[model samples]
Target: MSTSTIVPRAKATGHHILRIRGYSHTKAVVATGEHVVSCGFRVNGRTWRIKCYPNGSTMEHADWISVALIVEPEAAAAAPVNPWFSFSILDVDGKPVPEHTSTSYGIRGFTQPGCNYGWAFHRFVRRFDLESSAHLMNDGFAIRCDIKLMRAPSLRLEETFLDVPEPDLHAHLGLLLDTGEGADVEFKVGGETFAEHRCILAARSPVFKAELSSSTAGTCVKIDDMDATAFRALLRFIYTEALPETTVPAVARQLLAVADRYQVARLRSVCEDKLSGNLDKMTTERNANSPPVRAQPRGHHGTHRWFIIIFWFMELCLKFLNLLGLRRQPPRCSLHHSMMSTSVDKPHDDEARPLISVSTIVVSQRTGHHVLRIEGYARTKMMLANGQYVCSGEFQVGGHTWHLRYYPNGHRPETASYISMHVLSTSIGATEDAVHGKVKLSLPGPGGELVPLCTYHNNHGRCTFTKQDNAISFDRYVARDELEKSSYLKDDCFSVRCDLTVFVKEVRAVSLVEVPPPVLPHHLCQLLSSQERSDVFFKVGRKTFAAHRCVLAARSSVFKAELLGPMREHEASCIRIDDMDADVFRALLHFIYTDEMPTMTSEEATTMAQHLLVAADRYDMERLKLASEDKLCRHLDTTTAATTLALAEQHQCPQLKEAVFAFLCSSTANLRAVVATDGYEHLTSSCPSISKELVAKLAAAL
Candidate 1:
């Protein structure tokens, strides 16, 4: 007989399974009381087989046919095989026959030849049954065995799983806010007091830690410059790590100050984030109506170096006027110095019938009060003789830029002695309708007093500052005879003071999209945080919520009329709302500011939406009403269905009404309740048509 050697396959791990085909063929040669072996199959790169005895393999079981599986030439030099296997004798269709025996169990080291182990199969099948069974079809069969070895456990340095436990720190801290159970300290702010834990405050704030530990901390700490509401919000944040939107912006500045003073880093960070992220930023641009009369041009004159030069030039002019033994520099109104843009005193002229009348300068720079006083009047006097106009620094007055043109000697053909001054609107191409201002020009007298020289006042329609016409003039403004007098021109440096009052109506391009400012961190949210800082208060039953009047008026027409109308009710800046819950009002305020409905379950959201819907409808806030209506429509249940239907009927919310009808009709339980509730009666009176639909839906449900 020729033998075939089994070779190892590539890189497989664990035990190998082998099945012998036609395993029953050896039955013919298996004697009734003799040892029998079948052709082997390759297993783990080695041949293995079933060792059987037609009778018993051992004398003790001679009456039974025993079965055993063994390695043919036992793997003496190979790695140990720890295996579990099962064997089945297959029938004609390659299926295990019921009558045939199957063997399976653990085996020890099977290295040497004949070193075999297997399940003891005594009386596995009766001799008669084996001979008669299909397992021996044509005296031949197949045996299949499934064998698996536990994969070798390898030592590894890398982690196979990454799940680290984290402490639920904030949750525990949040519990401390309501229960000052271990609080050892109290604070007094305004007339109110608040309680807090000493350890927590000390841990969160270094200032608090030091102050509380000091000898003087035994007494109740009085917090000055901070209100009770703001202090309460601060304390809440300290304990809970969350800043409640109770009092803000109005309280924000105070709270920020307190946080800073306490050295509470996180509290400061929260305040900064709330203030910066959600706070309103006041714009620096001035109002456009009555522009700044003394408002100087922004670009050219803002430099300190140029201001210094202007200052020195005015000082020299004053010195020259003093030396000439003539009238001193004009009253220090504008040109002598830069008036603190807010000062608006009229130029003080000595004479009753003054030549120049100076009134309030334009308040904002956007106005047309562009005036420039050029010194060295004597130096420019030659320009008058040469028939050339002397110039003043360009200034912005009203809505247009202007510069003065002075013909020192005269504008006349003959050698005349008249001084001519003209104001030119620099923006000649501007399409502005008209710009008007009261122009006053005067000379400074001795002792810094103004000598009125020239004045012109007109309604906004006077000298136009539009594209077509741009200049206003006083030709032959003053005779050279009058100006050269000591009182008028002193030290060859007569100072001119021009006062102007202006009005400008600027037309801006109309935009179709009415883009309201971004409503966050909401100004109303800040206002809500501003408790005592608020001017308006809401008494929802007994609970009070302080708010700003501007915010209320801006949000609701009903509130505007109630708070600011001719027949107002806010005598004490308080509105009493008896029907709505305080919690619901709080939710309403939040919605007004953030436009975000409160987080609630479907049922709670629906219930609250009904009340909010009614409040919104009563307040004439269509947006809030629609928001509440939408929320109710989305979460309609039996509890809110009738009330929403009533609100929808009252507010004409067709979608919400339809949603409630559909929700009620979907279940008998809701319909039964809707019929029993008074809201349905109100709905019927308010909208009989909806009642008819509900009646039909109810009838159909029955």
Candidate 2:
């Protein structure tokens, strides 16, 4: 025999991170009381300061170093802003200083002094520790401050009314190169003539600026030594940070060399990042019958200027293939139409280009369903791919890509009890304020009654996805026994519906095109409701409320026992209720119908709130009773306080009685008027247990 275990997940509210650049000092050497501060980087238009004190802020804590991140005092005092701030030091290699420590939450909205958070580490880095550390070099240091704004940021993106022309810098530069428009210089190389803009070249490259300044040649100049093909690639990079997506691998290294020679840091980093990724995957990227980019073993540098020149010519030949528009056509290389045919020695006319990596392959879905079926429960490998515990294949919604990851045997502390799932989004080049998403996981139930097992589908329950932490997961999802039931999993198959909404800076409407409308936006309660289609009826005296048995049963166990249980009423279509007035029962029916109590004021609740509270107690409706009591407490005054106090004493609602005692004895409560009410006579006669608490409150107020 085998036993199964399920894990529940808990939700971590917010996650945040920030990357700071341009640290001035490399080695920070400070005496006691001296501190170093960082320059500001803008996020949501707020300037932040990271102050690191080598000595403590106070003389008493002199043995410790203090670190703090402060908001501009002027900005913070204008209005209270709720933000979560975190600070960290950077090592010499530009990584956050790894201090496995808890963060200080600054959620209490900032006032006059402004919002700040930090630690005065009594056992912070010792003087000797900094003196011998590799990270603390040249007196230069960097720190990052990240804020998780618990409150939503403004997402106002005003669309333009005018037909504004786009700033197409690349297209304009390409045009200049092609048509020689405003061309100030000309070059001749490898039997070809090219016209170029001297100003653009001068601004982009110091080498070009220096050469043009020293040149005596007026409109035309002869060039040698530099490969013409390399020069074309270099010119393109000057205008665009990246090459075309189809740029062949053979050309990447040559492009890097040209970028290095021109001292173009942006282009150099792009090339290096691409090369590094490809180099890492060389061994595992291909197998037999699939020709791949072979990796040369790590060793001394090969003196190979000829290979760079040859590959540059090879990439130039690809331009002709692009002109033919033969993209994605399985490579049938042809040296016959080569632009730089003489640059490299070719034994034959064909050499296959590398296949595009699978990482670029994506599935685009404006609207669709992601179905997950867990089978062979004991045999299937539960571990998720890429180090995740559980994950689904990529899916798209609302113009964003997402992947769902779940943990069945919960991660870490949550193991053996809950199920956890998270949705991760692809990083885009925008500073979005927030991304709110609602998802529902369901189990296939009889007659379209999908048992919603896991959900975070409400305004309060919105899972915010941020660029800092692209995902959110539940650590305590649900109890183990619930999922193991036969009704929850019909032969081990569970499904989920993922819905997402994202707000970006340049907000363009994402056309959903031919997708069907999703039902999740309305929630299941909408369908189960509707007076026209209810299956069961609750009759109270002369009034009746139409209801669905499934919904009532799903929300309340009491209703489930009466309607779906083995009781005689389970077979009956109508249930007659008495001892409750029509208006009071109707209000109670609304709570049963929606599982959400109505909002009430003390005067408004007076009509049926007291009777409804009694009915709620009889039917074991705790939420409705609490809601009623809360509204009554808010309305507590001399006229109503005595009545409420009597009701609380009868029902044994300690909280309500405590609220009444505190209110009636205080200056705002008017205790003399409360004592004159009709219920006060019964309160003193039937409820003598409140005398002590009442006397204590009266004494404190006096």
Candidate 3:
């Protein structure tokens, strides 16, 4: 089976600060319905402005302050613009007042004559409240507008699952071996006879193939050297490509010898790994009781002839030292320069060389992230002096406890004008050893998604944390002036995310077999195309489809209930399905058979996905439903947005509904285009509450 993936759209973000000097004078001079507009600033290659009405933009809100964000007409006319924005009133310290901050929930569209698309908060703040608050400092205040613009969505490569069955060739072969239904040969060992197929044995071993090809069909071969139990294990490995878990180390040794004689390389390797592990365990125990051995420094080497002379001299010295009770244990030398030598003493017999086996070591890392939101940023800066820090609650990552240390006034006096951040490991016994990892720090975007800051100070490569250095520090994390002027410091708060990846090492036995890829899906697809042994038939529209009842039952609970449960039709030969197109039904059958989507053009796939989503939901196929939802999300356009929104609402798909809403609300042009389509009328009639929800979302965004 095959799979497909959907990529998310890219976004460009920027912010503008509007400082109104002499606020009191503007309130008195500007009349209601009139606004004082700031110079246009560009974001995503489009110009935008902030409009503030000291006496409110309309008569109804004359006693309240009004603020709005507008897209420039020239830029809007070039193409539809979708942007998400927020407005916050800044205090004397240049920090946003929490109660005066407003954010958009989703994207808003801007088109030609962008006046109608501008978003405004009619009653942003009461005139009396602004006049009395400290924010109205020196007869003036500032407003920060943060905007995030949405670009066209594009596809990215990702791994997605297909509903293909797992490979089972070994299972089938093992079953054949156990049943012995087509046995044409026999092997006698220790007066015990075993029946087996000649072809099966010949294919697994060249020795068996040579012997079997020269014998008759019903020949009985007698094994004199090998035991019956070891022979049985060899046959099992040949058929299953694996040994039984019940195979003991003693039995494994015997099997290893037999496998080697028959050239069963995989079986021999498995036995060797098992025996090596047992030997390592025994050696560890023996060494634990003996005196500790100190490792020698590297890069020391001598000629082979000189090495032999030194080796004997050292041996004699060690023996003399032992005799004098000056040493409790004899020294074992490791010759690394010219040859690979073990610490164990060498035996006199050349044939008794120690067995060596190598284990595979896999080095990897486990990564996780945590976000620390610093509320009341201004207050924290004032309260914490240089060298003082506030720590976030402990969060676990890579099986270790960690926390973020935030120094509002900086960790050192030299960096007092900037913020300091550090990630400290707090695991018990952490000081005893070093934990190696890479660290990255970032801030959350407008949508609450972490955006990596990639600066030299924020992203530190390969840090080793030990008792000497238990934390990784970003001394100049962010300049206070830069952060105070940025959109991130909203509601007097901002968040910092720490992503840590700790390295881990693992050792395991090497595997000899290179397993083949799965073919169950291919076989199932062939069966579906052939319509072999079909137990059920469906009549959809004017076309008929043949399918296996068992396959359908296994994939969908609804199909199971309809075909095998108490609700099943009695002796019904051909069940009729209505309100579905024949092509959709055929596509559905293909997915059910092979767990893959059929190839189709982009436009056709988009349309088919909608219908298939409905069919999938009806049959309670969640994966298919999700796949369809993802397809519709990626293909959302002006023409299909309204219809897809209505479908999402009707089908109880929250994610799809949200995607449609985000697409439609991104720009006023999108809303207008969608409303001009016939689907908009159907949406309003079928899902009347959606209009209210859309308005509510827009209000929340403002």
Per-residue CA lDDT of model 1 for 427-462, tens digit only, reads 445335666666777776556566667876556434
- On a 0 to 1 TM-score scale, where does candidate 3 land against the true structure? 0.38
Please give each candidate's TM-score: 0.26, 0.32, 0.38
- RMSD, one per candidate, in order: 45.9, 30.6, 23.0
Candidate 3 residue lDDT tens string, 252-331: 87986797788777687677656555544444444444434433321232232234334434545656766888764433
Report the lDDT of model 1 for residue 358: 19
Better of 1 and 3 by lDDT: 3
Compare candidates 2 and 3 on TM-score and give the better one: 3
Candidate 1 differs from the real structure by a C-alpha RMSD in angstroms, to one decimal, of 45.9
- Judging by lDDT against the true structure, name the best candidate: 3
Instruction: Give the Å shift of residue 325 in candidate 2.
Output: 17
lDDT, residue 165, candidate 3: 37
